[model samples]
Target chain A: MKKLILATALVAISFGATAQRYFSKTAHIKFFSHTSAEDIKADNYKSTIIIDQATGAVQVETLIKSFEFEKALMQEHFNENYLESDKYPKANFKGKGDFSKVNFAADGTYSVNVAGQMTMHGATKDVSAIATIKIAGGKIDGSTKFYVNPRDYNVQIPDVVKGQISEKIEVTVKATLQPLK
Target chain B: MNKKVIIIVLLSIIAIGGGVAYYMWNKPKTNAADVKPNYILPADSLGAAFAKNEDSANAKFVKDFVALEIQGVVDNVFVNEGNESVIQLMTNTPDYAVKCYFLAGESVSANKGEKVVIKGFCTGYLMMDGVQMSKCALIK
Candidate 1:
């Protein structure tokens, strides 16, 4: 009985030591497109992000339909024609980065480059972006900006409105992560 | 005579198409404040559904763009990066809570621990976060 109890305690301790995961549900993502005719932008605040401090692995997933546009028709067209959100409901990014330079025990800001595969509209592409992360008072704040081209993702835009939409769209991400229990 | 008729028909079609394009570019969105809620429940119930099965909960509550009137205790009230007021409601789980993002020009007047009703469109459940509602309006 004594040996069994000792083994159980050891297992528990090992599990506790491996709890180095942080997560956030309210991450924000904004995409902006600039054209000579108009500037189009949309925001999606319901994003799921997970960061493994031990392995420096990061994953982010968000619903495509959650993006809100200024105009209702524009949103509808984006869903029905451009993105086909009904067919492809979510966009995700998975990658690994180096988090060794920053000490989680200390509060400070760190800049790191994360390379990952971004999958959207049923197409996947390699992407790398610089992330600014701040650890303050037990909370982690992170933000990054990247550019994506719709053509690369197989998103076709009608020629009639080609000049009204920019070829490259700028995507910005902001998240506040808390230690997962 | 046939060529003249064809030209008039083509001209009318072009004019109609232009009018439609103009309207689509300027269509008004549905105001969440004005619509009747499809579901009126406590915060705990909604949270429980997602906690039980996230995938099915999303299909039922999230995809349809259902308007909800959720009553719960205010956990935290703060302004987000966009300067929009956000009200978080307490749930059964500490890690998950319902967050309501108020529409622009709307403010959160409720204090923490106070019970209030918020109406908005349910976007979906963020895996680690609780359910999210956007364009929320405070109900008196």
Candidate 2:
């Protein structure tokens, strides 16, 4: 009976060790476009991110309509015309990186390269980015920046306002992840 | 004289259209303070619904910018990167809570653990853990 109890304890401990996934629901994602005529910026704070400490895999999901612009008309135009967010509601990224260089148990900052597929507006593209990850006081903070073209995601701009929007949009992501229980 | 009149009418139409477009591009936003909430419930109730099924909660609360009045204890109060005040309300479940982003220049007088009612536009669930509400106004 004692041997059986010990075996059960060992199994429970192993299960606990595998539960090293970190999650953040309040992550922020901002996209900016600059042109000679105007500069447009939208912020979305409802981004969801998960990072597996054991495997160095990361996943991020963002709701397109959650992005808020300063102007209501710009928001409406982005949803109705540019992104068609009602049709394609979400954008997601899944990537893998080498986390062997950093120790998850220690508090420090590590820069890593993540390569993944980004899916948005019913189109998927391969992307690689550098993410700065910091572990401090039992929390994981990460930030990254990347650039994307709307045309690559099947987002078309009418000729009338083409000059007002830039071809490449700069996207910035920030997250403070907490360990999942 | 007919040609001149036609040109004048065309120019007037173009000018009017330009003015309307400009007005639309710079129209004033709806005041959240004046709008009535579409739904009212406790923060725990909303969090529970989202925890149970994210897709359903999103369909009901997020598809249309539904306004909500949620009551709960203050879990955290902080400012975001945009320098906007945000209040985090605690729920029954751990890691699942209501995050309220207040409008610019708005302030909350409530401290942590104080029960407060907030009204805002529900942006739906953030993953399986959080309910996001923006442009929030405290209703005591």
Candidate 3:
């Protein structure tokens, strides 16, 4: 009976160790487009992020409509013409990295090469970026910057303002994830 | 005389176009105070609806662009990095809640477990997360 009890306790401990998942409801994700004619940027603060320490897996979801642009006209054009947020309301990324070297118990920063598929505007594309993961006070702060060409995802820019909006948009995502309850 | 009228008409059209463009460029973001909630219900029901069928809920709320006023027990309240008030309302579904994002200047005055009503535009439901509401305002 004691042997069985010990075996059960071991299994329970292993399960606990593997469930190192952190989540954040309000992550910040910003995208910027720059051109000689104009510079446009939008910010989305309602992004949801989940990071798993065990598998080095990360998932992010942001509502396209949640992205707030400074100019209402720009926001409308982005939603109606560029992104079509009504049809594709959410943008998501699911990816993993080699985080086996990072010591979660210690406070430090680790850089990992992440490869993920980003789905937005009813299109999916592979994306790779080097993400910085910082561990501090039992929380994980993750941030990554990457560039994407809207043309790759079939985001058509009208001829009238093609020069005003840059083809490549710089996207930055940051989240301070807390331990999942 | 006809040529001069044509010039005046063309100039008037150009001036009107420029004025419209200027007004649109300077238009401000939507204020939460001006929105009327299209759907008023318990927060738990809204979460459960999304958990049950995300597509339909998303169509009705996010795609259709309907605002919502949800009332429930406050799970927690905090300010995000953007200095916007975020209030989480408890739901029946496990690991899911109604997250309401208030405008930048709106102050949230709700404690954990306090019952409250919040109105906002439903953005969408993230898988494994709860429904997101933006530009939220405290109705009571």
Q: Which predicted model would earn the best TM-score?
A: 3
> Could you estimate the TM-score for every candidate?
0.75, 0.77, 0.88
Sort the candidates on TM-score, descending order: 3, 2, 1
Could you tell me the lDDT of residue A124 within candidate 3? 94
Residue B74 error for model 3, in Å? Answer: 3.1
Per-residue lDDT tens digits for candidate 1, residues A114-177, read 9999999899999999999898987789899999999989999999999988899999999998
Q: Candidate 1 residues B98-131, lDDT tens each? A: 9888764567798999999988877666656667
Winning model by lDDT:
3
True contacts kept of each: 0.43, 0.38, 0.74
Q: Write the per-residue lDDT of candidate 2 for residues A20-96, one digit (tens) a residue.
A: 88788778999999998999999987688988867879899987867878998998899889887656767899998
> What is every candidate's C-alpha DockQ against the true complex, given to 2 decimals?
0.35, 0.36, 0.65
Residues B13-132, candidate 3: write the lDDT tens digits.
Answer: 999999998988897766465677788999999998888888888888885347788899999889877878889999989856898988776687999988998888888887666888
Q: What lDDT does candidate 3 reach at residue B6? A: 96
Best by DockQ: 3
Error of 2 at A135 (Å): 6.3
DockQ of candidate 3?
Answer: 0.65
Which is better, 2 or 3, measured by TM-score?
Answer: 3
Error of 2 at B65 (Å): 4.5
Better of 1 and 2 by lDDT: 1
